[model samples]
Target: MSSAYKTSAVENTSKYGPFTKMVDVYGLKILGLGNVGGQPQVSTEFLNKTAETFKLLLDPNAAGINKKSREKALKGLTSYNVIQRVGVKAHITHTRQALIAAKYRAGTKSMTSIDQEQTSSGICDLMGGPTLLLEQAQITENLEHALHTITQFALPAAFPQEMNISSKNGKASGISGDLYKALREAIANGVYDDSDYSRQR
Candidate 1:
């Protein structure tokens, strides 16, 4: 339910208390797609709906998901829902590009209507895209938010031993070692769900 990475993050093994730290959750990095993903600029109108990782939790036909995994994810909001910071660097000129512009990241402030928030998500979407459809862009925005829940919230909360990592300083233990390889292999073979979290020496 709670993120457990509470106030100020004081020590390697000591500080976190029991409150839901808004800062920790709020600052959680969601989506970070950029133009430099090496693909040429498409019409800013394209919404990559195929990467629907968020929709996985709402599967009515999720017979593959165990009961425990299903319950843990579908808890908050009576369902699910946003991304915070986004990197922006599109060269959308008004005459040629219609809506987007060449600039730094857009912040969530310059809105005159309930629908026109300043923030953007999933690449260059804050200023809308080539389709010129308001509703479509809004849907893309919401999808970015849901992306965070699966990656940072519910999955780690339900299966901490497997998903969460341990470390000192900055190097994460077992990340590139034998344990990491075993875990990677297990998931590839569809056996990760049955494997133990603890790594044996």
Candidate 2:
């Protein structure tokens, strides 16, 4: 393996945990034990480091304030939903990487790259040239499409109920000006573009 590949493999494994779904210890040993006659050997420290890295990678708060922007900028989003969506994206990215590695290992492809690079337009692309762009684009497009379904179908179906509201006119309604204010503040400060007050409305 080239130094780049080795470095990325170690980093990714450290971040994502052994890629267990694709990597077979026995098969790796058969390939080479390095010094233990196909028995495979790894240090405990390395394993621990990998665990820590994986923890960081898989954390729902991995992106810190950045992920919050998505929720706050969009209409009718809650903090709870933001964290849930972050988890979903992380899992999807993990699954995509695993599939890539497994396909590469199975010889379905001659070789593949590992690292993701940020483009000038601020989007992410993988190392395999144009194909990586397509893959990432497809993931983004699919997720965006799914969001429409969630809002239109799943959310209404799941939360179909009349929530009571106290009105100043001594009547119960399903609206709250306070909720709108909270949402407005969240959009102004929590989102990326605070200047877009129109979006907050």
Clashes in predicted model 1: 1
TM-score of 2: 0.23
lDDT of 1 at 88: 27
Which ranges in model 1 have alpha carbons more than 4 Å from their true place?
Answer: 1-53, 57-60, 74-149, 166-169, 174-201
Model 1 residue 117 CA deviation (Å) reads 19
TM-score of each: 0.30, 0.23
lDDT for every model?
A: 0.35, 0.30
- Tens digits of lDDT, candidate 2, 77-192: 22112111011222345545444444323222111122221122434444343544544554454344334323432233233332112245543233445443454568678664
Count of backbone clashes, every candidate in sequence = 1, 0
Give residue 157's error in model 2 in angstroms.
Answer: 2.5
Q: In model 2, which runs have C-alpha deviations exceeding 4 angstroms? A: 1-132, 161-182, 190-201
lDDT of 2: 0.30
